[model samples]
Structures are given as C-alpha cells and as structure tokens.
Target: MSPRNSLLLVLGMASALLAQGPDLPIDPANSFKVNLPGDGPLALVSADWGRSSATARGGAMLVDLHSTLVFKNSSPRPIRGVSLLVLAQEVTPGGKASVTVPSLDIQSGESFPIRVDLRLMRPLNAGSGALVQVGLDGVLFEDLTFYGPNRLNARREMLAWELSARRDRKAMLSTLLQAGPEGLRRQLLSVLARPADNLVMGMQVARALPPTNIDPGRVVEFAFLQFPDSPVELLSGEARMTGTEARAPRIEIQSKSKRPIRFVELGWLARDEQGREFMAGTLPADLSLPPGAHSTIRRENTLRFAKPVNGLTAYPSAVEYADGELWVPAYSSLKDPRLAAALPASGEERRLAQLYRRKGLEAVVQELRALR
Candidate 1:
C-alpha cells in the first residue's frame, strides 16, 4: 500500500478499536438511578405534599395528599409506563402499608407531571400523624423490558425521606411549643429521652431541642444535653454579644461527632438598637456544617426569602422584619449571663442593620435572586 494509504488504514483501524471497546460498567450503586425533570431527580428533591384538614369520619382516619410529582427525564430515550409507590405508615406503633400507581408514561426528553391524590383509609392507630414514603419503583421500556428502582431515583427517594423528616420534625416541635413552655419541655423529653424501635422516629427525635427561654440581650445555646451518641457537639459555651452591623458575626462551636452537623434550626432572643425585643431564628442559609471539628455559625447580612419575616427581629419590637416567629431556646433564658456574652459587638452588627435599612421585603427578594 502507498505510505499515505497505509497511514489512513491504521487510523481507521484505531478508530474501530476505540469504538469496539467494552462499555464502562454502570456504577452498581447507581443502577437504580432515575433523573426526574426540574433541577434533577424527584426522589431527593424537596416537595410539599399539600395539606388536608382532617375531620373524624366514623372510625376511619381521613387524610389526603394533593401534590404534584414533577418528573424530568434527562435520558435520551422516551420513558413510558412509570410506576410510583407511596407507603403510608402509621405514626404509632404498627405495621406499614402503601399505595401504588403501576403505569404512567412520559415522552422521551420531556417532563412528566403527575398529581398524586392519596387518601389514608385508616387513620394512624396510635400516633398523631403518619409517615408517608413516596418513591418511583418501576420504569417500563417499549420493548417490554423492565427497569427496577433506578439508583439515581433511589437517591431521590432518600432525599424525600430527609425532606419529609425535616418537615415532620418542625411540625412536631411547633405543636409542642404551642402547648406552652412546659408542654414543649414535656414533648422534648418524651420524644428525645424515650427509646424507640423505629429508627426514623428516633432520628427525628434526636434533632429536637428544648424551647428557648427568651430574655432581652441574651444569646442562649443548647448542646446535646442528652444524646451522647449525637452527631453534634457544643464547642464553646454559647456566647452573646451586641453591636454587630458591618462585619459578619459568628459563634464558634466545636464538635466531637464524626458525622457532619448542619444547623437545621437556631433560636435566639435579641434587642435591637431601639431596645425592642425579638425572638430570632439564626440558622445560616447553607445548613451543612462539618463534624468532629470547630465550626462557626455566623450571621450574614443577606436575607432569605424562604424564611418568614416574623422571627427576624427581637421580641416586643419588630426590627427589620420577622423571618419567622422565634421560639424559646431549650434550657437557658434570654437573661442568662452566658447567653448575653454571645451577642456580637458593633462592627459585627452591620449586616443586620443594612438588611433592615434596605427594607426586609426588598432585601429578601434580592437575596433569593442571588441564590438563583
């Protein structure tokens, strides 16, 4: 063959070889992965399962879930006949039961939206609520082949569990607090201090803290007063300081747990320059914090739209806007000396002042846009 032709032949052979090489194994762990529409998978994405007002009807416990299932298909192939399974477990001690939608199809490269209308035929036998487990179980192929739980989709399921757990915990805490301080404490002790065979409930209880005792000019911190196995630690005694405006102010907390600790919720009572008291929720935007190390939970000037404006200001007076109504901390009161020292000095207080000066409504909207 001519030299040029020979070179061409060799290149052709190399290209063929590359094409024929074995395909990389799909991560066994991700074999069940399914990508939904929207930002990503529906399994792990946070969703609200819309609420239903329950009224006793005879002996049956009646609850309905009127929520949309947003499915995004990132795959090249069209998806047809998707099955979604929702497990509704009684909150009290009992066996679990579920509902299933066997076949729903979606076009390839398209988003499929489904509204799940669920009715709980049997009320939770014992507990005040029920645990709802929603998942995508099967995807049907055109050729009659079946795909089980997609690992990616399974991840979405895990995320759903997390989101549900968080919401439930919040509801539980809110109910407890509504019963008043003593009621809150009783609920905490019963839920947290008690031992349970249900891992989910235990985990939820593990994150619950006692309500704060709000006092003017105080910063109260609650450590893992009970759970030694807790995945978090309280590094420094909670310190309170005043006068944080320009610079970001933070509290240094040391952790002994191996798992990462995200500040899911933070409660505090403070007074603004006007001497107006308020209850505040101080958890940062990005909730995740490292574990087995010292970390700082800082107060930034940025406002979050998702957080309500009720709790942002200190009690008696509303400074800025309330993000959410503040709750009392678990152990110490707002007047505790330890709490008072935790407040920031003047320079550190600028962020909050700026937020209020700009007006909370506009500032929060801008902050939300920045997140996008």
Candidate 2:
C-alpha cells in the first residue's frame, strides 16, 4: 500500500478507537495525524485536530492549522519545560511551515496540552488530504539538550557559523586597523562590491560607513519620558536624536535581582499628549550588573526610519534580561511582534544559507571547519 493509503487505514482505526470515548468529539479521519518516536519519556496521549482552512498566498496554498496535542510524562522525572518545533514536513518540505510551541511544564505522569495555531504554505496541488506528515522537532529539556533526531541540525550549524564568524570578525578588525583609513576604505569598497559570500565580512564592510558629523546645536532635542516599570530602574540618563541616530549617555541602572544581568533590550516608543504613538525601535544594551548592583551603560543606535518625529515624549515600552541561561522578558512584559519583524536576520546566517544554496552543505561545513 502507498504511504497515503496506509495513513488513511491507520486513521480509520484510530478514529474507531477515538469514537469509543465520549470525550473525543473530533473526527480522526479528517484530522492530520502526527507520529512521534516512542523512545522518549513523554508519550502522546491524544491529539485532537481542529478545523483547517486553505487559501492562496504568494502562488502557494497556505494551510491554517488549529489543533491541540496532549503529552503525558511517562517517566519518573518531572518535566519543568518542553520546547517543541511542530513541523508539517510533508505538506511543506524543509519544515517551512513550523511553529515553536512555547515552553510548558508537565508533572510526572501528568498530561499537558499544547495548542497549535500557525500557518503552513504548501504547493498548490499537494491537496488537502495528501497525507500531511508531521514531525516534532527541537530540544526536550530545561538544560536545552536534544533527544530526538536533529533533522535540520540548525543548532550545530548555527553554533559552527557563529564561532567562525567571530573569528572572521576579529581577523577583519585587526587587518583594518593595520591598513589605516585609506586602505580600510579601499578594502571596504572591495568587500561590498564582491558577492556576499560571508555575512561576517559583509557586516564588517557595512560597519565601515563614513562617520557622520553631527551638528551638536541642531541635534533633535528629546525629553526623558518615564521608563517602563522594570526591575532595573533608570537612575539617570539623557538621549538625543540626530537623523537616524540616537545617543544615550550617562545611563545608570539598578538591578534588583541577585542574579547578574548580562543583557537588556528596551523597546523605544514615541508618544504625543493626544495619544498618538509610534514604535520607535529597540535600544539593546549589554551589561554586567552584579547581584543587586548598580551599573551604568551607554548606547549608540542608528535608528532606521523614514517618518518625521517630534521627540515630544520618548520612552521604553518593554524590557528583557539575560540572567545567565537565556534572555527572558521582564516581569509582565512581552516583545512587540512588529519590532521583531523589522529586525533583519543575523549577517552570518544570511551569508551561510546563501553559501549552502550555492555551494552545498559540504562546502558550508568545510568553510566552517576551516575557521580558526
């Protein structure tokens, strides 16, 4: 039997079994099925697929999914968190239509439900019931360890790329320093003219933008609006804007937690007294504030925007902290999705992916491994 027919037969059997239970109202035959490897401590209890709709998006069929997955901890160890990347691989290869289900905790032998509400774009002729194969990808532990097949191997690939990119950056900086201004300008132009083979090189070339002479007297004036209510209080600070540039000097902050903060992202917003608002962007500052310590940080941001602004009131709308393991949003705070969309992918990532498409994974690995 073809895989599609086998899946249909299995769906029929599962449907009959599910129909026997009073709580299972969903029809299994109509629902897309997902199969997970059975070697893990967490076991799939039941998956109730919800309604699906199809539409056209950019010459492809976009499938909107609404489903829930129930996983029970079958092992003795309590699970504090589970991060999963639910992928509809058969419908869209390379797992383009995947969603990272937010982390959730499940106690030993207890079942927890994860709701999926994401879109999947597939070939127009793939058909609605073309045996949509689903794969669960990503790490399964609090310490961020992988237990399943790394189909994408995104983690390792990114790690290798980042390590290599850092080395390339250091090398470029040393070379540029030794070359001086005229040589640096020539090298920058040459790198920019070449095809983007490496993101590190591209970024290094981009950062060599000719320094702008700011008119100190004509710099757009800005007032210190109230800082977002956060654990880190802004004790003293001032910011000035000058044509896509924002300079924050003498910024002081106090950390209330015992854990040292490694980084902070303060989202910028401009507001008027009449209630008009604009998402200015984000001011990301790296810091080393020891436990319950006070620290000062400086930021120089080249804000990208085309809108005219009257810096009547400018302040941070959100905050995030990297307490060691990971960067978490501040208490009762969430990142504005619009801001995230505006940000560009890391230079190394774009260049490496392009390299992969042009040269292949072997070439990518060779280049990465060759990095000192």
Candidate 3:
C-alpha cells in the first residue's frame, strides 16, 4: 500500500474505542449528545450493519456483527480524535461483547468512515436479534482538550484518572530530580506498568527524559517539497537537536489559495550525512492564513528520537490542509527507502504498544470489554 494509505491503516489500528449494536442497522438520528455544550457539534452521520454471522464455539454460539459507522464534523474547527460511549441497546439473556472505532483527524464539514467489528456469545435463553445503542460521550481536539455532552460520564471519569496521573507524574519527576540516575530505571519500569486508561501519563512517559540529559549544539535544516497541487509554500525552518529532543522554533508557510489554510502536518525524517535514516516524528501546524497570507508556526511541539545523531536534514513525509485535503508521498517516492521509513510514532503509541507487549493481548481485551 502507499504510505498515506498505510498511515490511514495505522491510524485506524491505533486509535479505536470499544462499543456494540444489533443485527439490523439503526438510524443515527437517535444518537445525541447527553451533556455536551451547544458549541463544537459532531454528528453521527449514519450507521449500518454490513453483515452478521453465528457459529458454534466450544458449546456456545459465537456471534459476529460487522458494521460501518459514519461521523461528520459540524463544528467550525478541525477535530483530531473522538470518543464514544457505545452500549448494547438491547440484549437477550446475557451476552458479553464490545465495539471499536478509530481515532482520526477530521476537517470541518468532512465525514469519515470507521469499521466496527463486534463479537459476542449468544445467551442460552436469548431470542434472535440484539440492538446496539451508542452515544456521544466526548470529543478530543488536536490540542488534547476535550468537550461533549458526556452522557456516559467518561469525561468525569477521565478527569479523575488524570488527576491521579498528575500526582504520579509529579512524584516521578521528583524522583528524577532527587534520586539521580541510579534509581531511575526502576521508576521508568513502574511508570510503564500503568493501565492505558491513564492516557495522559502514558503520553508523558513516552517523552520521558533520558538518564543523562545532554543538549548538543547540533543543528538541522528542513527542506521543503510542497504538495503537488498545494497553494502553500514552505519558506524557511530549522530544528535543533538536544539529546533525544528536537525542537523547531520557527516554520514559515505562504498560502496562495482562495480558501484560508487551517492546518498542516509535516512528517520529519532524520537523515545523517552517512545515509543512516529512520522515522523522526511529525510537526503539526494549526493555522488561519487567508488567501495571499503567510503564517509562521512557532516551536511548540517537541519531537523525540530513539538515539542522538549528527548531520541531519528533515523533510516532509505527509501534509494535510483545512479543506479536507491531504498530501503524502506518492507511491513512486517509496522507491527511496528513506522516505518510506519516516512515519513517526507518537509517545502514547509507544507506551501503549509496550503495554500490550508486556501485559499480553488478553489483558488489553479484558480492559476494552469492560463497560466503565
């Protein structure tokens, strides 16, 4: 698959939430915000059951519900992620099941499709046809801020968890500051042991500092390759590498399109003079540049590296705009292995993947199966 397509696949696999429904499709009109504010509206555009099947598994009947869910952004700004509280609208007897949809980036007025695959065991005394009910519990923005009616109280629950996580983070930072290097590894492992529900903590750990903090004076320049049909131009920018952290203080872009540009993401690749290369990270640009206007993105987000290197030059691997448009490496560009390898993984991704790796898939399955 092409890199952009691969990115879409990775995003789907990485950011899904759990939920469920019935054999028949339900009208999305019934799905409403329970406690959300009137601002930043997100709509369930549609929901349909694509297929269903039943089979005998060890003496119980196993059922599978495959579905397609469509969501639209009705708000003014762009959205990077969504969280829903999906419940089994109706179930006969008592069957256990869960549903999931990808966390995604959605531009204003744009709609996207997410595949829902649910599995449950048939209840011994249950009748045919189960109904699934879903609600908009919360919405996550690109800046990590959250909003929604929160009918399921997920926001409140998450807030409680985050508060606890903050305490834990403060303690860990204290350990790093006082205990010094010898006692650090044990704390790192302990932090990694936390559950995925501690989302904020997981993100912090991914960007955790190395035992020895060193700020090298090495500087790297960013080269621009504009989108094939893009009206935006990358004028100038550079990033400084200190230890494993890369910081870009200023990135300038010029817009020539009639429509104002609202967002842009530049994929970073670290290539040393020796040709050794790997995926570095991404620079996300949220802007409001009108036609013929130029915007300078300040150094705010920090990109992390697996190891320190020298003589690096960064390039754009992917780019997205406000008008529900995207720019990624063309299929032919994949011929250059370096461009193909720079798809950066976020810290949260590294933490959670490590969680699954150490705790096993069954642990993850159990966590998602719970209705909390």
Candidate 4:
C-alpha cells in the first residue's frame, strides 16, 4: 500500500479504538482490525474487542489478542464450518494463524460466534494499522461447497468434521426412530458413561525422535483391529522403539474398496505394562492410491509415547476419498467394547447430549429434525 493510504488507514483505526469506552487496557494503536469481505457467504454482524495486550520485550512486541466475532450466514445453505485467518505479520507467511470452528449447523441468516485467541511476536516499531488483521479464510457449507481462499486447507478438515457429525447424528436419529425416547436415553447414557479421553502428560511431538534417553527396547510389530466395512487393509508395519520413544515408523497398506483414497489416519494405540491400553494419538498420512494399489506410509520421527508402552497397535480411524467425501469408523464399530476408552464421544453426540441436558430432550429432537 502507498504511504498516503497507510496513513489514512492507521488514523481511522486509531480513532475507532479511542471511541471505545474509557479505561481501556489496550492502546488504540496497538489493537487489531477485523476485515471481512462484504460479498462472502458470511457477513460480519458485530465484533467485540475483548481483552488484549501488547507488551514490549527486548526489540519485539508480544501481542496477545482475544475477541468475539459474530457472523451471519448470508448464504442459502447451512454452514458446517468456518475458518478465520489471523495475520499478525502481513509480510511473513509463518506469522499467520488460523482458527477453524467445525460441526456447525447454522442455517440461512443465522448468526454464530467465533472466538479468536492469538499470541504473536513482531518488531516493536512495526507496520501501519493494528497489530493484527482478522479475515475470513474459508467457509464450508453442509453440501460440501466451500467459499473463500483455502490457504489453510480448511476444505478437507471441515469436510471431515462434517462427515463425522453427519454420521453420528444419523446413528442417533436412527436409534430414536427405532427404539423411542427411552432407548435413545439409554444410548446417550452409555455414551456419557464411557471413559473420557485422557490427556497425555509431558507429551512432546516432533518430526524426529529424541536421540538421548534411549530405552533398551525391541522392534514392535503392529497389530490391527479389523472393521467390517474398512476400505483399506493394513498389510505389515513396525516401529523402532527405544525406551519410551518409537521412531522410524513404517506401515504398508492397500486400498480394498472401489474409491480412490486420498487421506488416511491411523488410530495409534499403546498398551502399558499395567495391561491397560491408551490412545497414542493419530498418524496422518497423505496418499494418492487407487483401488487395489498398495503404498507404504513412512514417518521420519519414530514412535514417541508419553510413557513406556508394552505393545503397539493401529486401526484405520478415518479415511477421505478423492472426492472430498470421508469414511469414519462406523458408529457401531466405534462402540466396540475394546474402543470404549480409546475414542471420545462423537462431536454430534456431545452436542446433542449437551442440548438435551441444558434445554431438555425436545430441543435435541428439534435440532435433529432441522438437520435432517
């Protein structure tokens, strides 16, 4: 931008910040700006400049921003997800951050909320305008149509979330249709009673495994839990283990179904010495394999578990086809007794149950109806 335009833009932003109520903790010049395209599928309804700060550290500025942005779905279809791009350093590509909210079921003209919490580091005396600029990166509709520049690959991620949400919702709606309210209650109770996802303490994820603190470990051959409708087959795989870390992992698999597979995620699991199994995060690999074609998925970083694992196993957790469609473990498959503690409640399940708890059962029924 030219210097004349920059001066006007900065002055306008400063004046707007000063117009905010008094006793402001954030300096006007050090604040951020919201820039939403007027012709997009979503329209900015309001922006609340919530708590924010800019502290000088050495020759740089530490900017922390927290804001609530409300947007209306101006499109004709229901929105499944929204991703906002937060640009803290316009010139530096790495300084960009993205916030994506998935599993949304917003209808036309419906308003939704997005919370932006970001921390950035930039030169103390930096560019014009606010310290950050928030703009729309993408929006995924219920029909799989996407809007905006997909700079962050929001299309695939949003579609995956939508697919999962739809699958879980269909299962729940079917339960209600077949068994009535009592049966549905039993199902929700079972889901709510399952063990919650555990947080692995001191888990450090890196592209490569640590060299030191090696455990006198042996090679671990992977095992798989077969799903009836799985489109891919795991042939063979193993990980090099050293004490608590596993590295140089490799797995071979072949597509068994007709669809062209594009993305694969393995449900990595580890069994501790105490005879208990815990989820060891997912191994995501990009593939361009057709039906009956085999490929090897390799990772440079070896397997690093939060704790010493006695055994390791994997299963196809989710898969995406080349057509932007997804296939997740069947709701029934995920309900297996062995997987009860491994996977958390589905997004739709948690959402419906929360609605039922807060607003009663009828609200959930209405929501399911609207979704259908």
Candidate 5:
C-alpha cells in the first residue's frame, strides 16, 4: 500500500482501540494529547468557521468551515487519524446539535485539511442569540499541532493576510503610476480601497458629476482618485455609554472626518492583565456627505452588552469590525501603483504579490466572532 494508505490503516486501528465503552460526548474542557515521532508534547489549534448564508448555493442556509491541522514529529514514528471534537452553536439560542464531515485524514510530520458542512436542521422558533462550542478529543502519538480561527491562530492568520493585501496594493499602485496620470493614479488607489458596497454608489456619483470644463480623462481620473487610502478611518472618535434600552444597553461612538467618507467604524480598545490591546467591538455605519467642497463626516454606532458578560473571545478586531460594519473590501486596483510597488513586477511574482495585500490578523477573529 502507498504510504498514505498505510498511515490511514494504522490510524483506523488506533481509533478503534481508543473507542471504549459508550462514546461519550466530546468534552470541550479537555486537551487532546498529540504524540510526535520523538519526545515532548504536540500542539493543536482550531478555528471556527465563519457563518455565511449559503442559501444561494444550497437550498438551505449552511455553515461551511475550512480548518488546517499541522503535526510536528519529535520522534521517528509517524502518526495519523488524529480525531478532534469541534464545538458548534446554533444560530438561534438553544438550537439543535449535529455533526457532519465530508472527509478527514492525516500524516505524521505533515498537515491535513478538514471541512465541515453544517445546515440548520429546523427553523429557529425563538432565541436571543446562537450558541456554539468546540473541544478536543482522541489521542496523538507524538507532538501534534493544529491552528485555526481561535485567538492566537486568528492573529497569525490576519497578519499574513494583511501582508498579502499590502503587497497587492503596492504592486497595483506601481503599475497605475507608470501608465496613468497623477489624477488617474489617485483615482485607482481610491477605488482599490473603497468598500465593495460603496463601489457602485461611488461609480454612480462619478457618472452623475458633470465633467463641465474638465477633461474627460481628468474627470475619469478624478472619479478613480476619489477612493480612500483605507476604508473607514478614525479621523477623531471616542466611545461612550449613551443609554439603556429594553433589550440591550447602548454604547455610542462619534467621529468626524475630513473627506466625504463612505462609512465610519467605532472600535473599542480593551486590554487584558498583560496590557495587550485587543479589539472589543466595531460599529460601521453610513455617513452623510454634503455637496460641494470638503466636509466633516460624523457617524455613530451602538452596541448592547450581553448579560453574564461574554468572554474576550466574544469581541472582534478592528478589521473585522470594518468588514462587519460595512462592505467587503473592493478587489479593484489589483493594478494600482501603491500596490504594484509593493509586489513583484511580473510572472509568478504577480500571483505571490496578490497573496499578501489582503487584511490584518485581527480581521479573521472578527469574522469568526461574527459567525459565532
């Protein structure tokens, strides 16, 4: 048999041996031990899938997940079939529970990928919120490691995505700078950074604006240049507890901007005992823009804290808040100057360049939190 198949057989035998008595529900509190090839312990990481409405593709709304598991061997022996218990909550409070997996397998000193497809078994009748949980199960012979949407994993993921996005942005900017005029370059940058939802609106505005005495090229350039350095900057803002509501208390944030901004993001800065600043929550809302000349855009966001107080994992980072607060980032200007400069000029360089200019590490956490 092939090495992979051989490993699978070994794992199946191991799982059967580990399966004793009635299969108890996986415990969320316990840690799964990973045995490596050599000595020491294995590390496991898990990320929850971000919940997205899959109604368009599937008849019912479904939750899709992609998790990466990494196993490092400390000894010479190989390992496989590392069973893991995942915690999932219903979208509605007190929802039903079920588990489904398309496929699962692993190799020693190697990584494996797992996907979970979840669908709502029944309609949520009544509930304030949803509940999900994940835990560890099974055994690892040597040192095993896993990474996913959890706090640490999310941070690492976001940082990687951010680097990619920045690289892409730089490469695109470079190309536009070489081929287009100053105005066009600016416009390209703007469109690249504009929120996905706002792109159409911004385009509509560009079309409506009378070129008048302006050159058509320049007008096009102006429209393109209107994109921002980044979506939803905190020009000057602060968060405050405004009032109490019947459902949840309200927290308000007010901010002013120099340009005709598309949206405003209100982020809460909180730190643990270690003084590490983690994002609390983000509120994204549309800002009213006045006609003619520059204007200050003012906006507010309201958040109601949950009773019994959810833990830190409940909060989202700023990048996630921006996405949740408004629209997805526009993939435009994959051809702009700032983006181009940061990326390779050609070939596989283009593909590699596109990978790094996405978003930051915290954004992944926020997306996962939203799923929760």
Candidate 6:
C-alpha cells in the first residue's frame, strides 16, 4: 500500500445485535452495516465486528472492512461454500466487494465462520447510513446445489475449491495410511513451508475480439496436460499470441463421460522470457457436450501482458455436468512433477496448514478424519 492510503478495520457482533470495540477513534456513525437473512440454509449466529473506521481525505473517503461472522448450517445438508456481498458505497460504480469462503465442510447444524477484509475508497458525501453493507450473495451445498443470489458466480468457484479440498484431504489421508504419521507430518510440513510461486508478471484481459489487421503474433498450439479422470478429452487447441498478448483462444474437446457437460474451464501455464512458468488465467466456457460428442469452444477475449509468454501447457481446471455435478482435476494428476511447481495451493490445503500452525499437527489430522 502507498503512504497516502489508510486502512480501517470493521470489526463485532453477537446474535441479533452488533457489538463495537473500545477505544476506536470514532468513525462516521452507521458507517458499516451487515444484513443477513435468518431463513436461509445458513442462519446468522453471531458477528464479531472488530473495529471499522472511515477516514476523510478532501472529497474522498477510505473505509476498511475486516471482520468475522459466525453462522450455522440450519438446513439438512452440508455447506461447501459461502459468499458475502460487501457494498462499499452504493453511489460508486465499482465500489462493491465480496468475501467467499470455499473448501468448507460444515455439516448440518454445524457452525462456520466467514471473514471479510478489504480496503475501499468512496466519495466523502456518499452517506452516513451504512457506509458499507454486508449481505448474502451465495451458498453451495454438498449435493452440488446452491442457494442465494448468483451475483458473483460464486457457485462454480466455490464448487471448484470444494472439489480441490476433497482431493487434498484424500491425498493426505492416503499418505497417512500408507506411510504412517511421520510421512503425513512430512507432507503437511512440506506444503506449509513451501514458498508461494512467483507469479508477479501482470496481464490485462479484454473480453472482446482482438484488433484486426494488427501485429497479432503467430499461431501457437497448446500442449496438453492430460488427466486420466478428466471428463473431457482434449483433441486440439490453439491461440493467437504476440510477445505481449494472447488472443482468440480456441479448443476442441470430446466428452468421455456418460453425463453431459454444462461448463468447462481450461487453465494454461505460460513460461515467461526468463523461463519461469506461472499459471496464466482460466478460460471458462458454458456449453453442452453430450456423451461421445465433440464440440469446440472459442473466445475472442485477449490477454495482454508486459512480459512475453509461451502458452506451454493447458489442462482441464474445472468441469461441471449438466446435472449440476462438478468435476475437478484429481489431486494425483495435480501432483505431477510438471505441475507441482506451477500450481498454487488449494484453499483446503491452506486451511489445513493454518490449523497445523495454530493448533498443531494432531488438530489437522483430527479435522481431516472428522470431515471424512
């Protein structure tokens, strides 16, 4: 953050009333408010609004939201994910925010927490009546179903994370069963100690067709990173690329499964000029491909970056069936030596690592077993 930017934390609540912290430097009254429905699959249990403040800088204002909310799975199904909408300033064009909690395994009648943390800027004259509004955006259940508004496309994102969570847990459990506690400990330690991948090379994406008759680079065919469990088989794929941009991605696929596919997201790993590879973004397409059928997915979206990229490898990242069931790349496939370095840790992996850090290895093991 720059020196001119300020951050204030919105922090407390229990049950039906909102709780405030002590010694706060008095922000604008009613600057932050949270609205949650009581009749949803997950009911609001409590909120610990930590401490929130608004700072005025001439005609602009900075608001910080950082808090944890507690909710219970009041419905009969397990909750896989949740998303909370954070309204920074209703008057601002892009002032909205969302907090999504994925890789959750909260069973019926169980309690879970969602943490919201973001720094937003708004006009000072926006209003004193709730400078920020927090509400429900979406929730995903264990049965591959969803509740709440589908505003943020949280359904697919959460489902993908949940699938990854399940994969990670099973993978670690397999390690524990085969090699015992020491081996499992080593595995967890390795992930916890692993440093984050250096993916700092930036990219600008435009969802429109690339400019015609321009310096669009040569055509590049994508190399496949095949997964045995993937529902779709990649026949061929290619994209137009320049030193600073990749555009007009087109891929042909065949459904190998009995169920029809409704959605598929392809992720590519690109190598920079320095030979360092990073996960470039995903290209999600919503379509229908029946069993033993072939289809082609195309997009005019263009991705531009400062550093040149080689679209080295492409893989199936997320796939959803017509029945609303989702499929993610298996953990075993992601553990390939080729991908182990480029791929980032899943949400559940991060949670387990944090659990080990805060509560010890035994706690993680116990949680994993309980979830199982």
Against the true structure, what is every candidate's RMSD?
A: 24.1, 23.9, 23.2, 9.8, 23.2, 8.4
CA lDDT of every candidate: 0.38, 0.49, 0.51, 0.78, 0.31, 0.77
**On TM-score, who's better, 1 or 2?**
2
**Residue-level lDDT for 368 in candidate 3:** 31
Off by over 4 Å in 3: 1-100, 103-216, 272-274, 311-337, 341-372
Q: Which sequence of candidate numbers ranks them by TM-score, best first?
A: 4, 6, 2, 3, 1, 5
Per-residue C-alpha lDDT of model 3 across residues 45-111, encoded as one tens digit per residue = 7777656454544344545657677878888776655655544434433353333223355788999
Error of 4 at 161 (Å): 1.3
TM-score per prediction, in order, is 0.24, 0.38, 0.37, 0.84, 0.23, 0.76
Model 2: lDDT to the true structure: 0.49
Write down the TM-score for model 1.
0.24
- The true-versus-predicted C-alpha distance at residue 361 of model 6, in Å, is 3.7
What ordering of candidates by lDDT runs from best to worst? 4, 6, 3, 2, 1, 5
Error of 5 at 296 (Å): 10
TM-score of 6: 0.76
lDDT of 4: 0.78
Model 6: residues with Cα > 4 Å off, grouped in runs: 1-32, 43-78, 88-92, 105-113, 119-132, 141-145, 199-204, 207-215, 357-359
Identify the candidate with maximal lDDT.
Answer: 4
Q: What are the per-residue Cα lDDT tens digits for candidate 5 across 145-206?
A: 32222321222222323334444444455544464444433433444454333111010001
Model 6 shows how many backbone clashes?
A: 11
Best by TM-score: 4
The sequence of per-residue lDDT tens digits that candidate 1 reaches over residues 166-253 is 3333443454446654554444344433222211110011121222345223453433222233334344334332223112234455
Q: Write one digit per residue (lDDT tens) for candidate 2, span 246-342.
A: 4443466677665667665554544323344454544556677777788876644344434433342233433334532333232223223432222
Model 6 lDDT tens row, 76-126 = 998888988888776576578788887677999999788877877677666
Per-residue error (Å), model 4, residue 310: 1.7
> Model 4 over residues 1-372: C-alpha lDDT tens digits?
999999999999988665432332456445777787888888888887677776665556667778899999998999989999998786653467899999887999999899988887666567556777888889998778889898877877787788778889888889888988778878777766755556231234568744554454567788887788888989999877765777778899999989899999888767877867776778789989898899999888766677877777789988888986778788788777767666667778887787777887777777666656
